[model samples]
Target chain A: MEKWRATSNLRRSLKSILNRQLSSVSEFRYLNEKRSCQSSFNLIRDCKSLGQVNAIQHRCFSSASTLVQRNPSFSTLNSDDISYFKGLLGEKSVIQDEDRLETVNTDWMHKYKGSSKLLLLPRSTEEVAQILRYCNSRCLAVVPQGGNTGLVGGSVPVFDEVIVNVSSMKNIISFDKVSGILVCEAGCILENLISFLDNQGFIMPLDLGAKGSCQIGGNVSTNAGGLRLVRYGSLHENVLGLEAVLANGDVLDMLGTLRKDNTGYDLKHLFIGSEGSLGIVTKVSILTPPKLSSVNIAFLACNDYSSCQKLLMEAKRKLGEILSAFEFLDTEAMNLVLHQFDGVRNPLPASMHNFYILIETTGSDESYNRYLY
Target chain B: MEKWRATSNLRRSLKSILNRQLSSVSEFRYLNEKRSCQSSFNLIRDCKSLGQVNAIQHRCFSSASTLVQRNPSFSTLNSDDISYFKGLLGEKSVIQDEDRLETVNTDWMHKYKGSSKLLLLPRSTEEVAQILRYCNSRCLAVVPQGGNTGLVGGSVPVFDEVIVNVSSMKNIISFDKVSGILVCEAGCILENLISFLDNQGFIMPLDLGAKGSCQIGGNVSTNAGGLRLVRYGSLHENVLGLEAVLANGDVLDMLGTLRKDNTGYDLKHLFIGSEGSLGIVTKVSILTPPKLSSVNIAFLACNDYSSCQKLLMEAKRKLGEILSAFEFLDTEAMNLVLHQFDGVRNPLPASMHNFYILIETTGSDESYNRYLY
Candidate 1:
C-alpha cells in the first residue's frame, strides 16, 4: 500500500508537470476572437486551465441574460413537483440548495447562468426514466448535465429548467479483454476510465483536457474529437454501442458490443453527438485499444500555416500508425497562455514562431520510437 | 516507359505471389458447418479463393429460391420503364442481356440468384437520383448492385426487380494528402482504391478477398469489416463522409471530410451497415492511414480455442498498434481448403494442429518490427 501510494503520488506530480508543459497545446481552434473557444465541449478538446476560463468569463457575457427569453410552454417548478421528485428518487437525490444550484445552473466559463431551482441526481437508468416520465407529464423543461465542463453553454440550464446530472450513475458494467471492449455507466469520468483501462493493459480511444471531470456519456453525447483523434478517429468510430433514454422515459437500448453488426440501421450513432437533446446517454460500450509501452511527444515550431501543413503531411507519412495526435496553436494563443497561466514555461522561449505544433506517437518499443524521433 | 512497365510488372507479380501465399488465411469462421461463411459481406471479410467459393456454393443453398417472396406492392418492369431508363441513361446503360444479368443476379457464393430482367448502370449520383425517382413513381422494386461480391445474396435482385449497378459511376474525386482523406465515387473498385492510395503513400483501412471486384459503395452500404478491422476499425471509423440516395430518390448529402463536426445528427452512420435498405451510398470520403514500409505475417499452430484467445490477448498487448489482423481456423476448415483449392499449399504441412492462427503486423520501421517479432 505504501509503495502504491508513493508511485501514485509520483505519477500525479509527473502529470501535473506534463500538463503545465503541454496543456496549452490542445486541439487547434483557429484563433477565436472572443476566447479562443477554450477547452472544447467534446471529450478530447485541448486542455485549458480553469483559472483562464474564470478570468475570461468574468469579463465576457455580461449580457448573457438577454440572449434568449424563457418559453411560456414550460410549466413553473412548484412545491408539488419537487415533492414528487423527492418521493420518486429519495429526498437526498433532489437538490434545492442554492450553493449546489449555483454550480450546476452555470456554464463552465460561468458566462451562461440560469435560475434553475431543482437538480436531480439519478443513480440508475430506471430512476432517470422515472424522472423524465414525471417531468414529461407535468410539461416541465429539463436539462441533462454531465461533467459541466462544456465551453459553449451546453451543460448549463438556460432558464428555470431542472438539471438532471448523471454523476451518480457511474459504474463499470463489464470489460472484455479479449476484444478490448468496455461497458460503463454514463457518469464515469473520462480520467477514471482512462486510469482503469491503463491498469487493464488497454487505453480509451478518446482523451482530452477536461478528462478529469468530463463523463464518458457526455463525451459520447457530444461526439468529442479528442487528443487521440488524429490516430483513433472519433466517438462514432470508437463507440461500439450506446444506451440512451428518450425524453418520454423510453430507454433506447441500442447497446450491442459486437463490432461486426450489420443487422439493421445503426441507430446508436443518432444519439451520439446529438448533445443529449435527443436522449440522455445512460451507458456506453467503447472499443479500447491496447496500451502501448512507449509514447513520445515532439514540440515543433513552424514559420507559417503552409509550413505547418507541410510538416503535418510529413509527420503523417513518416509516423504512420504510431501517430496519435497532431495539435497546433498560433503564436497569439501561445502568448495568451503564457501571460494568463502561471508556471506554463514556453518550450520554445527563445523566439516566438508563427505557429506551434505538438505531435504525439505511441508504440510498443521505446527504442524504436526514440530512434524514429 | 519501359522502366515504369517493369516496375509495374514486378509489383503485379509480387502481389500475385503474396495473395497466393496468404489468401487462404483471411479471417476466423469458427468451423462453419456448411461453407465457412466463405467471405464477409462488408468491405473487410476473410478473402476466400474463387475456386473454394464455387466448390462449396455448388452444393449449398439448393433451396434458395423459396426463401423470400416478392412483395405485391412492387410493380413489374415494363417496356415504358425500360425506354425511360434508356432515355435518361443511354441504351448501353440499360442491360437486358441474360449473360450480364445472370452474373449480377448471382451472389459471389452462387447460392442466391435473382430473376431481374433489366439492369441499369448509372454513371453519376444525378443519374442514380433520376432512376430512383422514376422507379419510386412507378412503384417498381429496384435492387442496387455494387461489385455483386456480397455474401448471403444481398447484391442480387429478387423477383424481376430492376438492378441498378453503380459500376459506371467509378471515379476518384479528391484526395487530401495532408489529411489522408480520399473522396471517390462508390463504384471505384476496392483494389483500385488500394492501389491508388499505395501510389499516394497511403492505404485504405479495409481489405477483403473480393477487393478486386467489390465496389467501395457496396463496401460502405454493407459496412464491411475486413481484414484490417482488428487494427483500423470498421467502415464506421474510416468512413469520414458519405453521400446516399434515399429510397424516395432524395439525396442525403451527409458527406463532410472534416474529422470533427458535431452540428446535428450524424445521419451517415444509419446508411452505413444498413445494407442498402435505407439508401444507396454513392460517394465516400474515407480516412486512409499512411502506408507503412514494413509488414510481417506470422502463422502459428494452436491446440485449442482457449489458446487462440490467449494468443489474441497477448498479441493485442505485446504487438500493440502494429498488430493488424488475427485470424484463425480449425483443422477441419484447413482440410477443406486443401481439398478444394488446387495451387494452395498448407503452411503447416508436417502435422495437423487443432487450430491455425495467422497474425499480420504493419509498421514503418522494418528492423523494429523484426526485433519485436
Candidate 2:
C-alpha cells in the first residue's frame, strides 16, 4: 500500500510537470510574437527559477478545467446500478472508494484521467460477459482494462465510463510443450507468462519495457510490437487464436491451436488490433518459441548515421539469422540515459562517436557467434 | 503462352480428378452400407486402374456446374461501363478477349471461377482510384486483383464482380539503401522485388513457394505466412506503411517511412490482412532486411516423434540464434515427395528413420556455424 501511494504520487507529479511545461511553452510562443527580442530577454531574466515555474504554471492553469468532459450518451452511475453490480460481483469485488477509484481512473502515464464512479473486478469470462450485457442494456459506456499500462492512452476512459477491470481474471489455461502453444486468460501478466514459458524451456515472442505490468490480453488487443518483433514478428502472426466478447455480449470464439487454418474470413484479426472497440478479449492462444541456449550482447560506436546503417547491413549479411537485435541510439539520447539513470555506464567510450549500436545474437554455437563478432 | 496453356490444363485436370474422388468416396460410403462385403470387394476390383482413374474422374464431375453463382446485388457488365473504362485506360488495357478473360476469371487452384465479361488493367494508382470511383457511383462491384495466386479464392471474384487487375501497375517508386526502406507499387511481383533487393544487398523478409507468381499486394492482403516466417516474420511487422482506396474511393495515404511513429491509431494494420475487403491497397512501404553472408542446411533423421520433439528443443537450446528453420516430415510424406519427383532422393538413408527434420542455420561466420552443426 505504501509503495502504491509513492508510485501514485510520482505519476501525478510527473503529469503536472509535463502539463505545466506544455502550457508555458505555448504562452511563451504567444508572448514572443508581441514583444521585441530585448523585452523577451528581460522577461526571461526577471522570471523565477525552474522550481518556481511549476508553482506559477499550476496557478495559471488551475482556474481552467483540465478534465475531459463526460460523454452525454453514457449514463452516470446511480445507486441502483451500484447495488446490482455489488449483488452480481459481491461487495468485495466492487470498488467504490474514492482513493481506490483514483488508481483505476488514471492511466500509467497519468496523462488521462476519468471520473468513473464504479470499477468492477470480474474474475471470470462469464462475469465479464454479464457485466457488458447489463452495461449495454443500460446504455452505459465501458472501458475494458487489463493492466492499464498502455502508452497510447487507450486503456483509460475519456469520461465517467464504467471501468471493467480484468486483473482478477488471470489464469493459465493450458500449455502444450510439443507444440509450444500457450492458452491463457487475458489478464495474465506478461512477465508471469514469460516466467512460466521459461520453466517449460520456451519464451514469449514479445519483450517490452512494461512487461511487468502489461497483460497478454492488452498486448493482443493493441497489437503491441516490441523488441523481439524484428525476430518473432507481431502478435497477428504469433497469436494462434483468441476469444472475445462483442458489444452485445455475444462471445466470438475463434480460438484454435492450429498454426494454419483457412476456414473463413479470419474474424480474429479484426479484434486483435481493435483496442477493445469491437470486443473485450477474454482469452488468448499464442505460439511461444523454444528458448535458445547461447546468447551474446555487443555494444559498438559509429561516427555517423550512415555508418550505423552500413553496419546494420553488414551485420545482416554476416550474422544472418543469428542476429537477434540491432538497436541504435543517437549521442544525445545516450547522454540523456546516462544523466537520468544512476550507475549506468556507457559500454563504449563516451567520446567514441555520435551513435551507439547494441547487437544481440542467440544461437546454438556460442563459439561460432563469438568468432563471427 | 504455351507454358500458360499447359499450366492451366494441368490445374483443371487436377481439380476435376479431386472433385470426382470426393464424390466417389461419398457414394462408396452409401453403397457399402447397403451391399454385402463381397459385393463391395468386387466393386472395388471392377473399378478402373490407377492410370484410368484420372480420366474416369474427369468425366464424372465435368458436366456438373463448377462456377459460383453471381451476387444479385452486383450489376452485370454494361456497354457504357466498358466504354468509360476503355476511354480512361486505352482500349488495349480493357481485356475483353475470351481467351484472356478465362485466366482472369479463374483462380490459380482452379477451385473458383467467375463469369465477369471485362477485366480492366490499371497502370497507376490514380488510374485505380478513378476506376474505383466510377464503379462506386455506378454501383458495380469490383474485385481488386493482383497475381491471382491466393489459395483462399480471395484474389478472384466470387461472381461477376468487375475484375480491376493491377498487374500493369508494377513499379518500384524509390528505395533508400541506407534505411532499407523500399517503396513500390502493389503490383510488383515477389520474385522481382527479391531480385531487386538482392542487387542492393538486401532481402525481402518473406518468402513463399509462389514467389514467381505472387504479387506484393496479394501477399500483404492475405497476410501470407510461408517458410521464412519462422525466421523473418509476417508482413504486418515488415510492412511499415501502405496507401489504400476505401469503398467510397477515398485515397487513404498512410505510407510512412519512419521505423517508429506513435502519432495516432495505426490505420494501416486494418488493411494489412483485410483480404482487400475494406480497401484496395495501391502502394506499400516495407522494411527489408540486409542479405546474410552465410547459410547452412542440414537434414537429420529421428527414430520417433519424441526424439524429434527433443531434438527441436535441443536445437533451440544449442543454436540459440543461428537456427533459421526447423522443419520435420514423416516417412510417408518423404516417400510421397520421392515418388512424385524423379532424381529427388532422400538426404539420409531410407532405412535410417521414420521422421526427418531439416535444420537451417545462418550466421556471420560460416566456419563457426559448420563447427557447431
* Model 1: per-residue Cα lDDT over B24-102, one tens digit each: 2221121232221111111111112222233344536444343334444456778898889989999899999999889
User: Stretches of candidate 2 above 4 Å error?
Assistant: A1-67, A151-153, A157-159, A266-274, A347-353, B1-68, B109-113, B150-161, B258-274, B302-306
lDDT scores of the candidates, listed in order = 0.75, 0.70
- Summed over model 1, clashes come to 6
Residue A356, model 1, lDDT? 94
lDDT per residue for candidate 1 within A1-373, as digits (tens), equals 3433332333233233223212222212222322221111121121112222333445364443442345444578899998899888898999999999999988899776778899999999999999877876776777889999988777777668788999999999999989899999999999999999999989999999999999999999888877898888888888888887666676766677988666445667867887676568999999898888899999999998999999988888778767888999998998899999999978886786899999999988788888888
Q: Go through the candidates in order and give each one's DockQ.
A: 0.32, 0.15
Q: With candidate 2 superimposed using the best TM-score fit, by how many Å does residue B311's alpha carbon deviate from the native?
A: 3.7
- For model 2, what is the error of residue B42's alpha carbon versus the real structure, in angstroms, after optimal superposition? 49
- Each candidate's clash count: 6, 11
Please give the distance, in angstroms, between residue A154's alpha carbon in candidate 2 and its true position after superposition: 4.0
Candidate 1 ranges beyond 4 A from true positions: A1-67, B1-67
Q: Give model 2 RMSD, 1 decimal.
A: 15.6
The superposed Cα distance between candidate 2 and the true structure at residue B30, in angstroms, equals 30
